[model samples]
Target: MIEVTDHDGVAILSLNHGPVNALDLEILTELPTALARVADARAVVLTGEGRCFSAGVDLKRVIDGGAGYVQEFLPALSTAAFAWFTHPKPTVAAVNGHALAGGCVLGAAADVTLMSGGTIGLTELGAGVPFPTVPLEIMRYACAAVSSLVLTAKTIGLAEAVSIGLVDQAVIPEELMSTALKHARKLAAVPADVYALSKKQLQQPAVQRIETLREQDDPGVTEIWGSPATRDFLAEFMRSLGRK
Candidate 1:
C-alpha cells in the first residue's frame, strides 16, 4: 500500500491501499522501505489516493486479531513512523482528505503539512485506545492548544488546522498537488546535509522525548490494546460505522 513516483528530484509517496488508505501492516512496515528507495531524491511528498490521506488504523485488524495482533503491530507502527518523522530530508505531507488518528500523526510528523480542504484530528481517547507515545509527541509539537485538544480527541476542519499550526497551508483540492510540488522543489534547493542535520538538531527535544516515551510506555499501550474494555470499545466503534 505505498506507491512511489519520482519527479525532478522529489519522491511522491502515495498511500494506495484503498479508499481511505487506513494504516495497516504493509503501510506501516513498507513506508520506510519506500523512503529508502528514494534516498537519492532531494525531497519527498506524501499523499494519498481516493478520498483520504488515511482514515487511521485498521479497525478490522483489531477486531480480527485482538491482543496478539496489536502486540506486534503497535511497535512496528511506532518504529516505521519514527523513521519517517526523522527522515534526513525535506518532507511534506500533502493531505488530500481526511487524516484521522494515526493519519493525523503522520501529517504532523512531516516537516511541512498541506491540506486539501480536509479534516484532521486525534480521536484515540474517544475510541478507547491509548494514544501511542511518538504520535502524541508529533501532535503536541505541531498543534497549538494541544493540551486540551488531546484530552478531548478533538477533530478540526481545514481552517482550524491552519490556524492551530497543524497544517502550514490549506489549498483547494485541485491545487493540492501543485502546491505541494512547489514546496518540494523549493525545499529541495536546501543543501541536503544541512537540512538533515539542522532538522535533527532543531527537533532533538521532541525526538528525545518520543524515544523516551516509546521505551517507557509501549508495553503499557500494548497492554491496554489487549484489555477487554478496549475490545468492547473497538467493537462498538465498528458497529457504529455499521462495519459488522
Candidate 2:
C-alpha cells in the first residue's frame, strides 16, 4: 500500500491503496515496515498516489469485519501512527488532496505538513468513532484548532486549513511535490544527529502523553468503535457514500 522512491537524498513514501487510499489492516500493518526501510535516508516526504492523501479508515471493512477485526486493527493503527510520528528522520507531508480523520492525523504527524487542492480535518466524530490516543495526541500537537475540528468533524479547504495551522502552507497541485521536496531537502541539510535530537525533544511531550494515556484510553476507544451503535452508524455512513 506504500510506494517508496528517492528524490535526491530524500525518500518519498506514497500512499497507494485504493482511490482514496483508505487505511486498512494491511496498510496499517505494512506502514511501519516501509518507514523502517527508509530509516537511513536523509529525509522523507509522504504523499498520496492519486488525488487524495487519504480519506481515513476503511469503514466498509470495519463494518463488515465487526468487533473481532477492530480488536486487531486498532493496535495496528496505533503502531503505524506511532512509527511515523516518532521516526528520527526529518519528515514532510505533501498532502496532494483530501486528508480526513486518520489521514489528517498521519499528515499532521510529519514535522511539517503542506497541502494543495483538497479539504482536510478530523471527521472521526461524524463517523461515530473516537480518536485513538496516538492520533488524538498528534492532532493536538500539530493543529491550532483541534477542539473545534474534532468536535465538529467538519472539513475545511486548503486556505482555511493553512490559516488555522492545520497545514503549514498551501500550493497549487503542480507545486506540491516540488515544494515538499524543497522543504525536505532543507531539513535534510541539518546535521542528522542534531536534527534527530531536537525533533525528539520537541516531540517528547506528545509522545509522553501518548505513552501515558494510551493504555487507559485505547480500550475505551476500541470498545466504542466495536459497539453495535457504531457499526450501525458506519453502515449508514457508508451507504450515504454509495459504498457497500
Candidate 3:
C-alpha cells in the first residue's frame, strides 16, 4: 500500500493501492513503519502512482464491518499523519490527482505541498460523519488551502485550492514529480539543525492546539462515529459514489 524509494538523500513515498488509491486498514497500519524507515532522510516526497492521490478510507471496508479489522485504526492514522507533520526532514505532498477526505488531510499535513491542479475535498458532511478531529496544527495549515470546505459540503478545484492556500503551487500533471523533487532538494539544502528548529517553531502553537482538542474531542468524535445517522449516511454516500 505504501512504497518508498530514496533518491540521493531524498525519500519518495508513493501511495500504491489500486483504483483511486483508496486508503484502507492495511495501508493505515503499515504506513507509519514505512515512514519510520525514511524519517531520518534529508527530505521526503509523498505522491500517488495512479489517477488519484487517495479517496480516503475505503467505504466498503467500513460498510462491510471492516471496522474491527483495525483495532487501532484511527489512532494509527492520526499518528502516521503526525509523524509526517513533525518529520525532522522536510516533507512534500506531490498531488497528481484528486485527494478527498483522508487524502486531503495527508496532503495538508506535509511541510510543503505541490499539486497538479485536480479535485480535492473534505466530504465528511456528505457522509454525515463528524469531520476528523483535526489536530489544531494540521487545521491551521489545511485551512489556508481549503477553509471553505469546513463551512460546507464541497469539492475544491485546483485553482481555488491554491488561491485559498490549501496548496503551495499547481503545475501541469506531467511536471508534478519534478516540481516536487526540485523543491524537496532546495529544502534539503538548508542546514539540518537550523531548518528543523525553524520548522518546529512554526508548528509549536498548532501542536498545542492539537493537544488541547484531543482532550475535548472524544465526546464529539464518539457520538459521530457511532451514530445511526452516520451509518445511514455512509451507506448512502457509498451508493452515490460515481453519481458525483
Q: What shift in Å separates residue 231 of candidate 1 from its native position after superposition?
A: 0.9
TM-score of 3: 0.92
Stretches of model 2 off by over 4 angstroms after superposition: none
lDDT of 3 at 113: 76
Give candidate 3's error at residue 34 in angstroms: 1.4
Q: Which stretches of candidate 1 lie over 4 Å from their true place?
A: none
Backbone clashes per model, in order?
A: 0, 0, 3
Comparing 1 and 2 on lDDT, the stronger one = 2
lDDT, candidate 1, 22-84, per-residue tens = 987768999989999999999999999999999899978877888898987887788777877
Ranking of all predicted structures according to lDDT, beginning with the best and ending with the worst: 2, 1, 3
Clashing pairs in 2: none
Task: Give a tens-digit lDDT track for model 3, residues 1-244.
Answer: 7899988889999999998898776787777788889978889999998888887777666666534533345566677777778888888999989988788888888878788967987776677766545533575665764446855758889998888888889989889888889999999899989999999898887777777786577556656665556667788888787678
lDDT values, one for every candidate:
0.86, 0.93, 0.78
Among all windows of 10 consecutive residues in model 1, the one with the lowest summed lDDT is 140-149
TM per candidate comes to 0.96, 0.97, 0.92
- Residue pairs with colliding backbones in model 1 are none
Mind sharing the TM-score for model 2? Answer: 0.97
